[model samples]
Target: MIRLGLRLTLSGGREAAARLAVIAAAVALGVGLLLSTLAALNAVTTQNNRNAWLNTGAVTAEQEHAPSTADPLWWLLRADNFDGHLIGRIDLAATGPHAPIPPGIPRLPGPGEFYASPALGALLRTVPADQLADRYPGHQVGTIGDSALPGPDSLVIVIGRTPAQLSGDPEARHVTSIMTASPADCSGSNCRVGTNSNGMDLILSVVAAALIFPVLILIATATRLAATRREQRFAAMRLIGATPRQVSAVSAVESSVAAVIGVAFGFGLFYLVRPLLAQVDFTNTPFFLSDLSLNATDVLLIALGVPVGAAVSARLALRRVQISPLGVTRRVTPRPPRAYRVIPLVAGLLELAYFIGRRPADSGGQIRAFLPGIFLVLGGIVFAGPWLTMIGGRLMARRTHRPARLVAGRRLSDDPKAGFRAVSGLVLALCITSAAVGVINALTAEQGVPQGSASLSSTVIGDYRHYDDHGNQLDSAASPPEALLSALRATAGVQGLTVIHADPHPAPSDHLAGGLATCAQLATLPTAFGHCPAGAQTASVGPSFSVVGLDRLLSWPAVWPSAPATAAQLQNLPVDQIVVATDGSKSAIEQARTLLATAYPDQEQPFTIAEDRSQMSQRLSGYQQLADVVIAVSFPVAGCSLAVSVAGGLRDRKRPFSLLRLTGVQLGVLRRVVMLESAVPLLVVAAVAIGTGFLTAQLFLQAQFGYSLRAPGAEYYLIIGGGLVAALAVIGSTLPLLTRITGPEVARNE
Candidate 1:
């Protein structure tokens, strides 16, 4: 039977060959996308393994008290007990001639020989060898290999000295030990390596898994469309005494052939694109082509899964047609989609309601609860799509008097499931685009625009420079000198001398008038507060703002002028200041900042400028990049699905369209009919999908982030409008095929 199927397919001539080729091409594209995605995942996994090997330390313990000997430190550094690899370190000294070595060194060095990690070695080389001994109080002998360190980027140095030689300052302390993985722990080739802890692997894995379903759907839809023309042939075979099972076998054979060809082509495609995929740096480091390759198991999965999946989909599509001795009966009119399809949607809404009613206090917890709700809502929308499409078709039929509309509407009403499936990819793309735009808008809505020339082009002062890696300012850090402040005040361009002092006490009341110098200054700023008393100190007080009344105050870093600053409430917090130039010129402001910086020769905290506009642009740019990625992945899938549907519809209607052409139907009318069939449903579905997405995003934003809903911007509308236009374009592209199928030659053939 399989041989017979193959023979028939080959001999079926040009049309059959063309159909097979189209099906194979579509399948290959889908398979290639999936394979590339998997390959990228493998690359990430490989990079993770490399990182794990480099980061040898697995566990760490901290001790407040210093140990008597360096033996415990060596144990911590080189310990290989069953309780995972251990490493820990404590400060050895502040500034002295004799100091204990830092962590990450493989072994204690002799008095004249000290070892450093590559990063530390680089730093040591920058300083003169004689100065290194005086400044670092250690003999910099050599650098340690990566194997002895936790990560290649680490900066560390080790010194060999007795406890008596170490500094006795209260802040001076030595690490008892900093351990690494024992050899046995990393012994076997099959041992699992550690992963990069950025959580991107899990996220990418989840996204890839989600994408698999849609890719498979596209593949199945493509194959089903390709086989629509072959249904009558299958029915005729059944009439000639072929069993239903035999008919299925024939389908399986045809599908398996196409799928095998496609999978092979897909592998070649993946190989071609592997280099491009290697350029994507999700972890800030580009992965090698070898890292992003398909292993043996991945190859086997594609080799077997694609063909089997295609064959199974073919069998399922053919199940709706009855095969008997007389002939096979194709069900032109499908049953109405069930209303019960909405149960999931309703249940999801109820779950959201339940969650909202509980009113979870923690915003993070609310977001976690909302994630499951999001999935449920998506499933509901997908399952309910056919029913919605049916209703839309009926409404369209009633509203229009044109023959094209009537015909297209009836067709959709009859097989809404097909119509729904055809537009499913498009609808999903639109929804996701709308949701992303809406959420981004809502999050950024509260940000105020910077006022006047107060842009980052000017110089400002803050405590940013004095802070160490741990965010604590160095003890020797001092306020900007009185001379620099006076010089800046006397500078020609200097304008707003706003000193944002750390308020030791702010009135706890939530009245704007009390925080402001007077109601007059408060009136100059945009405030949500209403009704103020005529006094410098009103009964109402919440947050304090500088009395300077600068409109460009929002440009300052980490400064929320209207909102209560928790940082300001801390006792003895350092004061920060912003110097805006009168001319509001970037060069002038920059010149002022330079002069201020020069005042403090050993400047720990340098002057800065708050360039709000550029910062906002950068933030929006990032959001746009994210949106572009989503659109790139989704739009093509949807467009292809629409194209496939049009092709399939034309195939199914070939005879009817030919008869219409023979009966004096104008070519333009026929074209209109085709356009209406694709265009009307798309317009209706896109509107519904976009609306749903926006509302879903609004609800999530309100519940999860407590952000006020903001209207989507012009770009959001443009994306949705573009999707509709693209759908129409895809439909139009199929018209040439319609002309070939609906010719008078087709009518005369039968």
Candidate 2:
């Protein structure tokens, strides 16, 4: 019996090779990604943490006497395992009148670093663009306090000068070093800093919640194994005295072999792809290279557990096969109680209904409110698959003409669950394709009219010394200053002019507002703030602005004069002076005061700042780039999962495919049948997923993000068509196995 069993299994190996080959391939790929992800995580954690001490940099103070709700300094000083720790005191004028000098590591600049993109290094808090111009005309620059945090990204300043620039300042006494921090360091650290394509860290967390996808994946895998593996083969072995456990063991052995090989290959590819990803300079991220890694545990689990899991799953399914191999012919399929299959869907719907009616009261604090949409979509897909299959099968059955069509239609009808399998891949693929298309569209779009202004003409201000609008330098020791403005205005299409100026602040990043200002005419100063009156105070310019009343522009909301800031609020007081921003209102208020103060009463200011139109959709595009990082991993993994499903199915039917030629069916028809077989099932799954994903996007993205998605063109077809094609290709790759499986039947039985 053992010899016969071995012979049977061996003869069939060529046919079953398709299943083993594909599953092996998938396992290898999946394992590879798992390894690379682990490796990358470890590399980042190890290298950047800088001996743990650097990773945990913070301020510690000695509050010997304190209350439970006391100052943060006291807690810092009261370390349970107290050893010498690095603490850099941040003395801001807002926190104290004469802030004491700090006493710790002095933060210094690294070498050969000229300009770190705002995306890289420590996040410098953006000093509002309007505040870059000299406020009191010559107030020496300094920082005071922090305002509300925008989100996960902490704001820091990227000064133009090196750390050496301020080496001698009294303010530098306690000033320590600056290093990049992970989002977890602060409540809002997870914002643009460490997040991916799925919004920010919060949304990424939601996407990571996708860890659950694999549990179901394992189940589906087990189900497919049972479906393809015949009942009588296992039963006959048992009848010949092999124990049921032995059969289970064999199944597990098979699964393990395939998983190990698949994983090894998958990880290799993941690392290979890392270099490509590294080339992309993600916005708002510092540029640096870090080594990648693969965790030992993740590899071990996939290698060891997948086979065991397959065995356990197969045993549960095969126990019934052992009960009665005599049921052979009918064993190709058996009826189940309607409730057995129906109950799962009913249960899902009930759960879905309950969830919708009573969303968890603690659904959110800041960004979590929108995660439900993803769940709603995934659940909807799971529940809707069978229905979609039934509908799609019905439609296919009507149109099918050849024997292949007949076979395809019959297969779909015989097992509705197969439809679910097909839909899963299709839906996932379509979602990814649509999302990719959207991303491509967004990245290529224009930056738009300009930020924070209504001026019509383009303006640049950092290089104020030379070039004119026509790209020619003034070519003189003295630039006409307004000559470029005259040239542009002289052109026919020029409606308005804009201006950008360098930040007069002392820090190197002072140039980074990169001092963009806009106006209708070059002579028109960025107004009130950037310009200094001839007779104004001769203070060296730091960060100061001339106050403008919000009452002046009924349009611009960002800085309206009604907000009421007086001269007293100024760190240094100028009699009859008020602090303001580079914004238009401040410009107007400054102009009025300066004209009254230094007396330039007759200047031309035109159509106001409020007239500019901005495309708010671009912001979503920015956020999407971040979201991609968070959710990008899922797409390829899902594709691999579908690949295995298709490959496995083809392997299971190799013998049957070979046997079909004996019935005189054309090889072409049989091949078509196989393709249809895979396609029919998948279309349903995609349909189900599409419905679910759409609703989920609506509920989550629209409601939470204030982003609206519409079919800008034939997006629906593109989504559906793309999904089906990918599903077909992955499953279709198994076609060559058909010829191999069918070609060798004569030798086996003879």
User: Candidate 1 on 246-354: residue-level lDDT in tens?
Assistant: 8899888888888888888988888888887777644434565677788889899989988898888888877654423233354446579988987886676566656
lDDT, residue 173, model 1:
31
State TM-scores per candidate: 0.67, 0.59
**What's model 2's lDDT at 282?**
34
* Separate clash counts for every candidate: 13, 66
Name the runs in model 1 displaced over 4 angstroms.
Answer: 40-202, 205-213, 277-298, 322-332, 357-372, 446-476, 480-625
* Per-model CA lDDT versus the true structure: 0.57, 0.41
Which candidate leads in lDDT? 1
Clashes in candidate 1: how many? 13
Put down candidate 2 lDDT per residue, 1-750, tens digits, no spaces. Answer: 334434443455664565556566555555555554455444434333331122122322221222233111100100000011111112221112222222122222122222222221222234232222211122223331122111112222212222343332222322122223433333231222232223334433443445335334533453354244555566666677777667666655555555556556765777677666444423332223353444677667656665566556655556566666555434465442132343443443344333443444432433444344444445545555655565666677788676777778767766655545644644554544444344333333332223333231122111112345475323211112344345434434333333333222324543112122221222243332333333332222322121112223222222211112222222222211112122233333323222222221011111122211112233444445544543445555555666666655665566677677776767788788878776776655555455544444433433433444454348546645654566567667767767765665642552
Query: What lDDT does model 1 reach?
Result: 0.57
